[model samples]
Target: MRISIIDTSSLGDRSYLIDDGGVAVVVDPQRDIDRVLALAAERDATITHVLETHIHNDYVTGGLELSRLVDAEYVVPAGDDVAYDRLPARDGYVIEAGPMRFEVLHTPGHTHHHVSYVLRHDTQTAVFTGGSMLHGTTGRTDLIGADDTETLTHAQFHSVRRLAGELPDDTEVYPTHGFGSFCSATPASGDTSTIGEQRHTNPALTSDEEAYVENLLAALSAYPAYYAHMGVINAAGPAPVDLTMPATVDPDELRRRIDTGEWVVDLRSRTAFAAGHLAGTLGFELSGSFVTYLGWLYQWGAPLTLIADDPKQIVEARRELVRIGVDEVRGAATGAIDDMSAGSALRTYRVTDFTQLSSGIPSDATVLDVRQDSEYAESHVPGAVNIPLHELLARAEEVPAGEVWVHCGSGYRASIAASILDARNRTVVLIDDAFTNAVELGLAA
Candidate 1:
């Protein structure tokens, strides 16, 4: 069997396309479906099965669209009623597709209907241990309809224990999620593990059964509030979305939207957006995982437009928007900021924070402390003006420019403050490290 593991790291996700003799089965796919389809076509393989271990909450699933693209059988665990087309899968139900033989095991704990598949090839064995049985820790049980943590924990323990007894020691284990994934907080950092290694070192199996239950529950990080709604989105299926890049909008058209109250998402590198962008556009640094962070920042269904640097970055921005169900990418502004000047006035500046401001004295600039009333009340630069970071979008006119110093408690909020002010066409100096060394200089003086 040939297996290709696709990782959605920024979203805490991983998936695979396992091929048994030129026929493929894709497991736990993300919204970006083209990559999976392209891989199958390149290898001359036909995708006969699309399997989802359980309904996930982190990113939208593309299983339905993938099945549509490949004309494959969409299989999910039984007991949950899902929309779109699907073949119900249950425990001990063996299915065959090409050379792949699947032994489905009902493994609940992560959810009431979670299942793991044991795949046997001609020469070797492998298990698709979904969210239920990960490398280190079990999937968190607090999501979906899981109300009884203790009950779910008990079910999880039994599920892991069941795997130990049924799957042989030599069976290599492939799970859908890894450590960084919110699916399981303490997922093993590495990609793959064998049943033998998990038997010996998987945290849940190694700990005492009772302790395992308690520790697993205690170790969980903060779960996202959107999880409940996402569960529905996953099981039901995502609404049709455009993965192809949207047509480019004139930069002048983009400015019009901002004027009418639409949000202009600047998906440029922080450095690029910091240098120059149209006024009132929100800057989000796009590098590792845009979809993941976008989901966190906005409501799942919020409408947004791309203010990318140019044509190429627009594709990246649109893909990210689809991943978290924020699919309305009216389109990107071609020549972005440059397009603005011919039609309307534009601006630029360097972003900085309190730490940067404290390090040096321009000796002839005004310091703008963009922190809140509460933050300012605790401590603020004595001579610095107070305008909290959140309010900078509207209060930019108050801060004096011409080598203006912008700062926050540390440098994070300060950079944002600087960016907002810079977007307003001011020459601002960053004082990110100002307070850290302010007293030392005074003493020296």
Candidate 2:
């Protein structure tokens, strides 16, 4: 059987087109379904099945749409926890595609509905291992369905060992997500791997249970607040939307336009953005919900240009816009950071503790807390005002002006909040806390 691995780089999600003669099946498809259809047509294969490993939390799954287009069966592992139309998958069920056999393995840990399908050929075997097992890690069991992380962690252990032990020694492994994704702790480097390679070198397999769990939590990056809602979108899926590329602008013209009214977005890494970023631009770092934040900044669909230090980074920024449904791009600022800095107003501040903040909070300064209402009600900076990070744009009027000390649970939300205030033409400092560190420091002017 011939197969093609489709990589949608934005979400680090992959889909497979498994072709056995003129019949094919797609697994874990991302939003752009046209690509899959075109590929199938090119191979002169009829796509008859769309197999979902689970209801993903990072991006919309295109299984529903692809099935609609091809009149194919949309199949997923059988489970009562969630609702899905089409075919339900169960353990030991074998599907035949001419000469190829798809052997189902009910491996649930990353999620309860998750499944791993082993493609058994005449001589070679490959496993479409979604979140059940990855090259460097296993799935994150702490997501919605797997409530008790501790228990789920142990369950994941057995599931990994089962796959490693039972699968053919030469079986190749292909996964759905990658390193930056939240599904697996350390998503595999390449789109595919072999069971033997992962069994020997995968960190999660090598470490003991205690060490493994501790490392998983430590490596867990801050997922978007919107990730919790992604299950709904993935279940039903989205109709294919026309995605537009940003219009290119002359470097000088772009600068003049931004100065007049356009916004600047620095679509770089979080570490790159934290070190230094454009004044008044959101510091979200081109992750999921990046366009959500852009909407927060410019709901008017205001024309904006990008300021990616790396020339190729403009493409990355544009991908984020299309993912979240933001389409306004005036152009990208070209040339060196120094050239971009010229004739442009620059805003800069350092992250401060409550002690340092105490010296800055006064008539000219104000403190703003960006945690959710419940977090704020439980404990927050004394006298500090509330404006949950997500709702900042709509409630901008409620925010008091002047030099501001903004903060959230950690510093990520605070940085995002600070950008909001910065765009509103306010000078702000970030207080690295979810508590009254802002209040104690009196950073809000």
Candidate 3:
């Protein structure tokens, strides 16, 4: 028996491919299915099943398309109100693929329909606890709603305890969300752990149900704004991902699109974006956290034009955006901002350090903190309004009337906020310095 882990680092999500004597089962696949197909070919395995633990809220699942391509059964939780056809997986139902056997276990915590699959081959056992259990923590239960938060958190406690009590100590545990994922109540300690290790170390297992629910609810951070659309899209069935490069448009075409109010996303370094960019363009660098902010600020299904330094950056940006169901990439324009033939003037923002900011901020200027809510609660510059980068676009109007001074934990997110403020034609100052510098430089934090 062979098991392969497919880790998507940007979203901090994992999928699994378990192969037994040339037959395989795929669990919690991402939008890009090429890697899964390539793996199957390398192992000379026939994909017999594609399993989903729940209708994912973080990203689009490729399970439906992958099963269609491979002629395999696509299994989804029985209670999910999805429009597409799938094998209804219920608790205790067993599926066999060659020497491997998977038993379904309903675990309704992360979502009302969530389930875990336990696979066994000979004496070895492994459980794919998607969004229910993690290395040392459990999945966050707040994604559903404020009304269901306490209900789901309580459900999570029983679900986790059930796994620990029913499974053997040595059983291998593979969870879908953790390993730096915001989906977890806390950052995962490691990528993998056994039932025994998690039972001993996982806080969810040690705490009483009431305390566990309280702590779990308190620990959740704000998830991506794009998350609200994922479950609905998944339930309706997402379109197959198009891997081909988007059409390349000239400056005039890009200008025409922008004139019609289309979003122009500039994928460049924060420093590069601050130096110069197309006026009104969103500065979303193609870094690890790119998708998080992109999904946060971007209008779903709205036509989008991409501007990058090169073709490579556009390709990378598109790959990440599609995972969260932002597939309306109309076209792209590649070159430095100065090289574009469009008649519009290049725009730039003034970036200052903490020392300069500490000297004195303008009385009318608003200090915007673009970090997470938790980070703001820990320590923030005096008089700084907390509008996390992800929520800035929706709440930008709420910012007081004045020049906007934006700062994040690091300068990265502040740069993003600065760009948005610039697009809104607000005079902006980016505090492109570490947050700790604010305290050390004698600024109240």
Across 1-445, the per-residue lDDT of candidate 3 in tens digits comes to 9889999989999999999788999999999999899999998999999999999989999999999999999999999999989999999999988888999999989998899999988999999999998999988898888899889888998999999999999999999999767788888888679999997788888888878877787788788778999999899998999867799999888878766778998888888888888877888888888887788778878988899989989988888988999889989999878876487788888889889887788889888999988898888887889998888888999899988888998788888889988988888888888988887877745
Off by over 4 Å in 1: 145-150, 224-228, 341-445
Q: Candidate 3: how many backbone clashes?
A: 0
* Pairs of colliding residues, candidate 2: 357-441, 358-441, 361-442, 364-445, 365-444, 365-445, 366-444, 366-445, 367-444, 381-436
Q: Give the runs in model 3 whose Cα sits over 4 Å from its true position.
A: 359-365, 439-444
| Residue 135 Cα positional deviation in candidate 3, in Å, after optimal superposition | 1.5
Ranking by lDDT: 3, 1, 2
lDDT of 2 by residue, 217-299 (tens): 66554344446656765655554544444565564675566567667666665455545555556666566545555544454
TM-score of each: 0.78, 0.64, 0.95
Q: Return the candidate ranking by TM-score, descending.
A: 3, 1, 2
Query: Which window of 10 residues has the lowest lDDT sum in candidate 3?
Result: 335-344
Which lDDT tens digits does candidate 1 get at residues 279-347?
A: 777666666645544454454455577776667788877776677677777767756576654466555
- Model 2, position 115, has a per-residue lDDT of 82
Over all chains combined, what TM-score does candidate 3 have? 0.95
